[model samples]
Target: MKTAARKTRPAFLDAKRGVGNWAEATEWLRDRGIEDIECITPDLSGVPRGKMMPSSKFTSNTSLALPSAVFRQTISGEYPEETGDFRYDPLDGDLKLVPDLSTLSAVPWESDPTAQVICDIHNTKGEPVVYTPRNVLKRVMQLYTDNGWRPVVAPEIEFYLVAQHEDPDYPLKPPRGRSGRTITGGQSYSIAGVNEFDELVDDIYDFSEKQGLEIDTLIHEEGPAQLEINLRHGDPVELADQVFMFKRTLREAALKHGIYATFMAKPMQDAAGSAMHIHQSVVDARTGKNVFSNPDGTPSEAFFHFIGGMQQLIPKALVMMAPYVNSYRRLAPGMACPVNNAWGYDNRTTAFRIPNSDSAARRVENRLPSSDANPYLALAASLGCGWLGMTNKIAPGEPSYKTVNEGTTIDLPRGLLEAVSLLESEPDFARIFGQEFIHTYAGVKRGEFETFMRVISPWEREFLLLNV
Candidate 1:
């Protein structure tokens, strides 16, 4: 019975809410009676890492520092040994947090009046910390801007609602619904399934509105207790910020409703896996014209090149798109996920699907990334590959008309370590995403895989304990 209270939109929550300078941010905070500010940045794992301080001390000129080592830390909280391009500063130096006032918004779930702003990481010399996930995204966007092209993206993220459990050893179960029955079976687009958790869904909407995030649609996915949220398309950086914030908002809202929401690529066996499908298109920066279509309204060469780039580079860029060990679970053949980097028009099984639309709305939907991916890194890699394609005029292969099933040769990395190796060995990605970041990301992922290998799984114990 935890329903959100109806409230009027806050004045600070305008369309231009976060576009103003620090003075405007201060005014907004003051009007909302914000007591604290959460200065956050997305680390390699997409986890929010930063300090929270009293609003009185936050300003445009406020100097805050976090260790550069944060970017090198693995998801397991362990650091890999210094090797090759993976070494961090011996002093573990500080990186300054320069708040992007455009990302400032209220933390609506908080009882205390609080605000959160995403920050840009900078070294002591004021150069961008290129490995930070958010900064990595900005670096890619800069490439598009330099070429007079502006990339736009819309992400559809899927997740599941599960009963709260503390033990990771136990398999997750779908949470009980309003009828007090556990959710079961496929509920794709089921209105009743979505309405089962109507109160929680309301909170999610309320929270997103307060944070200036927009939800295009919410629908029940094919998996039990699974749901997907689509975000409106716009600038890659802003959409990344919204996705990052949306995850937090949904999780918080779920907790309040006495359940857990998970974005794991494959949180359960026998159920469909989760994915974050990105719909992308580039436009002439000056004219806001869709570059994928010509004046004749036919598919432009740039469109094919973008698909070619995705087909050629996504295999190497898999580490960024599917970052975790469990992420590979969602990419297996026959899982309703793409196993190859095939391109096709309106083909759900291919990695790149060009949806049917008018010339002005032409775009490619990248169906490879898992829900566990860092939104910033995912968008950066996806857009970076497309940028390379158009610039180099790479030609795409013939589109597929059939499903890429088990018999098809998989064009993607099958595991996390393989993905990391593929990424590290690809010089093109090193040039695009930076050698330093590639090294650090590979190192961290390698460490995570090693940590996972140390664990004994249920399958091993169930079958191998006596048989082996």
Candidate 2:
């Protein structure tokens, strides 16, 4: 039996004692008269799940036993009764949740001054549960470290903010073009765009600074209401945490101002889709030099192997990259979306693009994943593919230079069914993701596809129903 190796150590173990631990966290709350705590753990779908505890019961010593089923719940948030009759109640064979003191952070949007902590679920035997998303990421990180390489990542997240609609019955409208009244505007990297959204952007910067996130830049993208935020590169684990927190913070901040923010890949079929393009490289653990860079100012053999790994495993990992039925709509050729499992030097048409920058910035950018994906799962899939590439020495194909919109072709999975089938058929991915996770994820997504197939859309009603 091949046991999974432990990767990066838990942040709680190395966290500064007087900074964010439970004791200091409690004192920080007491100083502000906070009377409530929002204890949460990210579910399979990346949604936070947990209960609010009163301040009196949320002391430093407070520890709750959560059920292992919380990690296996369906998209609708229900557990399978057939599996040991799992329920949210304490009497239902609950697992342990020892507070991860390092995750304690203030909930900036809450009026009562609440703090939130991300927890790790453990079994009765005090073993780390394998089913948890955090654990999956940890295991993958360990693989990288064991290989004598440190993975560094920075995510470029693109999203939109729209006007709030008061009427619940109002029909959804298509996103207007670049000419529409936007919160900001300009050519791709304009300072004027920042000026338009100055206040909101400032709030985001301030909030991130307080939370100790190393945010780099905020820029307005090509789409009318689109904006992108970049975080400084760091260890892959910390980078993933930053991605999770950044999305949560953006949503919370948007809600306070009565604006709607969405990370949906393609909110408008006519416009470019939003992507969470990941920039990644492997570094020498001791010297801190990027291992992917070569002396000739080109990618090293290891870099090609890493890219090959991505290409080989991407078909199987599509479900993780594009989690929803709607996500498939964004994978079409052209419109700045990648259609083929190919790589290029400074080309956006390819699935993986190597930016034409200096050796320091020479890294692969995977363009497949959307902003709505679970960050941990996406990172795991990417890392897994890269690892497989290195292990197998998979050769990367040639570069694609033509624009996807100009009829430049590469074969991509046509629809959700194809993607799901690809994932199910790949043995390499099955080995890494494990049987339980693969079944649960594929089952939920397949269920979603079935639901979507059975439903009639507005397009069908407007054209097919009337014409046919």
Off by over 4 Å in 2: 1-21, 31-33, 74-93, 165-187, 294-298, 408-410
lDDT of 1 by residue, 94-129 (tens): 999989988888898999999999999999999998
Model 2 deviation from the true structure expressed as Cα RMSD, one decimal place: 8.1
TM-score of 1: 0.96
Q: How many residue pairs clash in all the candidates, one count each?
A: 0, 1
lDDT of 2 by residue, 1-468 (tens): 998987974444333221455566656667657678777766677777777898779884666777666665655554534322222334557777756666666676677767676677677887776656666677787787888888888888898776665653343342333344544333477767656666677778877765666789888787656888988987776777778778888877766656777788777666667888899888888888888887777678889999999987887787787887777777776667887788888888778988877886679999888887888888888888888897789998877776544574546666776777787788877567665666666665665666667667777888998688
The candidate that wins on TM-score is 1
- Reference-based lDDT, each prediction: 0.90, 0.73
As for candidate 2, its clashing pairs are 7-142
